[model samples]
Target: MAPFTPFFSEGLYQNMRRVCSESEESIHYCSFPQVEGERNERIEQSVARMMTIIDLARNIRERHNKPLKSPLREMIVVHPDVNFLDDIAGKLKEYVLEELNVRSLIPCNDALKYASLRAEPEFSVLGKRLGKSMGVVAKEVKAMSQIDILEFEKAGEVTIASHCLKLSDIKVVREFKCPDGLTDKEVDAAGDGDVLVILDLRLDESLYEAGVAREVVNRIQKLRKKTGLEPTDAVEVYFESLDEDKSISQQVMNSQELYIRDAIGSPLLSSTLMPPHAVILGEESFHDISKLSFTIYLARPALVFKSDAILLLYGGNTKSVHGLETYLLSRDHSNLKSEFQLGDGKITVDAIEGFPARNVVLGEHVFLTVGDSVLRTKGL
Candidate 1:
């Protein structure tokens, strides 16, 4: 499958490029400390820096194949601290009216905090009231002071853009087994050729950042090749906490570990293992699976794989097939009939009427008593 291409807006991309091309002197001069103490010096330095950044931005736009057509609606001057608010304001007014072609230079204490606040409906309403009190247009002033504007520009749109990499085109099969003194060779054989062996490395959430995930993928690929296997069929192992004493339950723990390992190892999958794929949903991650499922479907995957028990179904989609036995195995037989609604179609029950749901093991096919009759269904 082709690697996922990230999407970015043209305006955001151009703004970022301009910020990156700004000079170090200009950045340092406009930074909060240099402009804080002396009012006249701060204004002079800020205006000079703004002019330099704007000029570089224009040059980049003219040279690039794609250029920004629309001028910026506003320029927001962000200060690191509010101690020099008055000085910052004066500098902003001069720059907005003189240097940059923007209509205003709205001074914000923290740009990022402002952006986040503006995102809230309550803040939006309060902003209107505050704008009215100050005799300024509320919608015209948007905040983003907390973020280092220069750094944001340097990183480009990729930094803030959604980091979702749709892997619907990749195909994979999952094999489950309890660790039962199985040798590495036997496990490798079960993989049926080259396979990614994901070891559940139980790590704290803080350690699973993008950089760490990339590192893990690279390390796993090396391990796979060391065993004399192709890179695509490389074995990827992750450590996940299987013990119930840990916060995560066994099923949830297994699912999350598998998902993370699979995503990291996706780029290295062989053709045989590649299929349309979907992201694994961790517990307490997203609210609804239906939306996630829709996103996966839009990527054009034929089937969706999820370890969660709850399935969200929407109208005008392909009818889903469920095995009577499979459902019973994952859940207790008693809980099964109560957990799901039966359609008009005939279902085979595989357990006795009062059979406790927890005792039902996976892969059992039996008749279950529901209402006045017995129905048969497949188990997990």
Candidate 2:
């Protein structure tokens, strides 16, 4: 809430400078952005409180270097009144959750448990009212108990040292208590009156591990962009890890495969190997090789494995296309007596009569059947 300011006239130069202010906020009662609509004080106050929560959450993320791309596990909101909590954790829940990127929201009424709430008389506002007794009033205001403060908040007034005081005569200050096993740096807190927003800055391994899939999607989209692929263009996504088998990239691929596919509007291929006759659009590596390293390739959908009437490699895992079988097969391509090469192992048809064209394997004599056309891998 902002206090209204009355207009005052200074010298000619000062008045001219005020009229030529660069920011509207610098001038009082500037209403250019205001729409001609009915104003509801209740709704307006609700929005103001909601925005305060959001602002504090954002400040925590920025100051602590927690990027919005990464998600957190939980947020603890504490206030004295349950109705106030309901207004936030109920009416305006979705907006806060999305903005904070927290998986869960917990509300508590014990503000005194997490913070020390006290009142400090506004010396400027009090000096006009009490004149000589302002100093005595200030000490009693600081020494006021939590119960006394909460009670005074409702009526917006209290009496200290036989002098009646109003809420405007003082300001409520909240000093949050830091949790055990955590330093002040690890916790961030800000309040609008009694509304206390506490954010734990520790990173959640599970949430971040899941977030890796989002990073993969971002990279794949970048690769798609580098190759000048259009939004409607359907391509295949391939992930190859330079590290261990159960690598971060592989885990994200396995866990968030569906998310990756849906985000880029493409299918994630099972096999990391390069396919024949496929136009290699582009390949990108994670910029931070020290922490995470993986290769992502974007290419035009070059081939499909349709053996036993099922999809192959990594394509089998995706269930978006119905009526298509999905399987991962092991093979031994030993003892093919004839030498053959057609469409660079994408196709091979012998000179024999009345023989259907079958897909061939290059390294091993493996043939993939795709209805009338066969994408063959030649045994090398």
Candidate 3:
């Protein structure tokens, strides 16, 4: 009966609806869910800041015509004072990556340093304190150069018409006009208080591959819905890209196989160069996207991979593998290198030639086998 009846709650109610069962007709008849943890305002503030940063990133994506699924190379968060974000940014870095769909989140000290800034007086706040002199104060503010505004804000006060105006009376706006005159996709947002979020809109090879992966995942999910496949039903995926350049299609399939597999509930996924001759006895689906197109063949589970061959200790996305890749370069690579704990089990993969393969694990038994070296990991 609640407005936010969760799926889990609905399932529980359905199971208990029978008279023979010791359950109620509906979750509304049951007690409210118990609170197992306490809420902290400090944590709330940190999360709020993270959300604000995400919103800022989304704005840049929208303005540049880049969809949320497409990953950007980098996003720079600029706030002279990111009090709550300081710790959260370090602790919850992965959340930022997935939410913003950016390869990296760079928290910079001065995001506005490269761009021009204009300070406009928040007339409502100014009028209340300055009375009729608000107009005069705004004019003085408009006359001030970008540097002057920065200096004024740093001082936290400005003297206009001999009246001392505190920082509360002024609002700073960051403009995307680059002083260096090099053209780039750039945008800025004024976040809570004086924080400004600036995003660098450029996609390198690595980031472009990530974006392609996202597009493939979206297309596959759409195909699954069109074919009326159940969410829990595992299916075999055969992807054929419409892209003329085979390299681009292969690169996406290579880089984002794990993501595609997890998203579509498929244990066995692959991109085929040659199209299947005819619609097999298998239930298959086909679809095309504007930028990226593919045909996905879905088949009921027949066990694509042997369980004894290779197994993931934990049932999770490949992001954990990506994290391991980053860890190898950092000083804190010791603990995770031995074993990565996920779900109910743990996985271990040794690095080869200072790098791991794009698809760390495939099928069931075939895990990473790099260059002549095969690091056998145990499945718990």
Best by lDDT: 2
Worst lDDT window (10 residues) for model 3? 367-376
TM-score of 2: 0.66
- TM-score sort, best first: 2, 3, 1
Cα TM-score per model:
0.17, 0.66, 0.60
**Greater-TM-score candidate between 1 and 3:** 3
Every candidate's lDDT: 0.32, 0.64, 0.58
Is 1 or 2 the stronger prediction by TM-score? 2
Candidate 2 least-lDDT 10 residues: 325-334
Residue 119 in model 2: lDDT: 90
Look at candidate 3 and tell me the lDDT of residue 220.
62
Model 3: colliding residue pairs? 309-365, 310-364, 310-365
Worst 10 residues of 1 by lDDT: 293-302
lDDT of 3 by residue, 61-141 (tens): 777788887676666666555555575468767898877777777775563574457788888777878778878888998
Clashes of each: 48, 15, 3
> Local error of candidate 3 at 259, Å?
3.1
The TM-score measured for candidate 1 stands at 0.17
Q: Flag the better candidate by TM-score, 2 or 3.
A: 2
Candidate 2 lDDT over 206-307, as tens digits, reads 676656766667778777788898888756666777666446656666677566657876545544454564566788766553246778877655434444
